[model samples]
Target: MIITRCLRPSFLAKPRLPPLSGCRQFWGWLNAVFNRVDYERIKDVGPDRAASEWLLRCGAKVRYEGFDKWQYDYNGLPTGPLGKYKIQAIDATESCIMSRGFDHLDGLEHLEELKLCQCIYIEDTCLERISKTDNLQKSLRRLEIISCGNVTDKGVISLHSLRNLEFLLLRDLPGIQKKEMILELLQKSIPPLQIELDLKD
Candidate 1:
């Protein structure tokens, strides 16, 4: 891990380049997509823009529109044997991927992990969209919804759509005051989901 981190920056240090061709493409895509924000390095500039930039740097195909929104464009990319999709974190903030922003993640055929740790606008709709993903039912293994203010029992209930899910982490939401639905479904289900929650005032 340390070695990979050390070599990532050498991506822009030299002009001729080395065997790390992916770095070249990484920068190329960042420049092409943002077309603004002179990206010297992946730094969090706030408004979740930095997270978006970092996700792009990490090799995820992305699209941005309006003030603070983004989506993965996995269309032109390969889809057969070695399709590139194993998203472990969606560490975005400010306005990135709010409300129905998860609509962007719907068909990501290989996404294995999800993180919406903190966002003001994250709500049931986003969770609903994530639950409806065609690929999530088959591939998702872990999920995190931490400190998101707008999510509720409705959103948590929507998770029933993720039949293949194995682990879940829910924390610090204003809604979801009761545990009947959350407890009843998950506890009785087969291949029981590993659940962790913190809903304290």
Candidate 2:
């Protein structure tokens, strides 16, 4: 009697994926959680505090009104009165903030400066959302978008909605062509808005 051993078919074997594949998925989920907007939380704590929690959780830094130091550490955030710490500036360098989470910017009445650097997920829609935010359009003055590859002239031009914007800085945005034309258009739309660009000619 000859006994034959059944061999597993190669097609049934699992393909090797990158070792960090699971890590990538974990990070993606974590970022989503961090970016989640709790409208109730916003109402209960006010937009500044709620937005502070979101930004800090997503690895961004925020400076509150009348504060010279940036608040970055998630655990070390101020325990002072919630409404007292109105967010005045946001520096989201290398942070995971995406357009879906920008509802936090909706009611920021005092936000004057914003910096988005190396924010891999930022795109035209993100800028569009910012442009359309009523409070931001009225109060935001200084803006910086650096090393965010997805931003293009369309996104940059959407800043026209920010009627009060005073300054804009663009650097290393490979997606922006006709840099000169974009500059001209932005200056024309917002006459008081000064712009600085480091995009390659």
Model 2 per-residue lDDT tens digits across residues 94-126: 999988799999889999999999999899999
Cα lDDT computed for each candidate against the true fold:
0.59, 0.92
Stretch of 10 with least lDDT, candidate 2? 76-85
Estimate the lDDT of model 2.
0.92
Rate residue 62 of model 1 by lDDT. Answer: 37
For candidate 1, give the lDDT of residue 112: 67
lDDT of 1 by residue, 50-98 (tens): 3344444433433332213335432342232322223434544432344
Per-candidate TM-score against the hidden true structure:
0.56, 0.88
Off by over 4 Å in 2: 1-23
Would you give me the overall lDDT of model 1?
Answer: 0.59
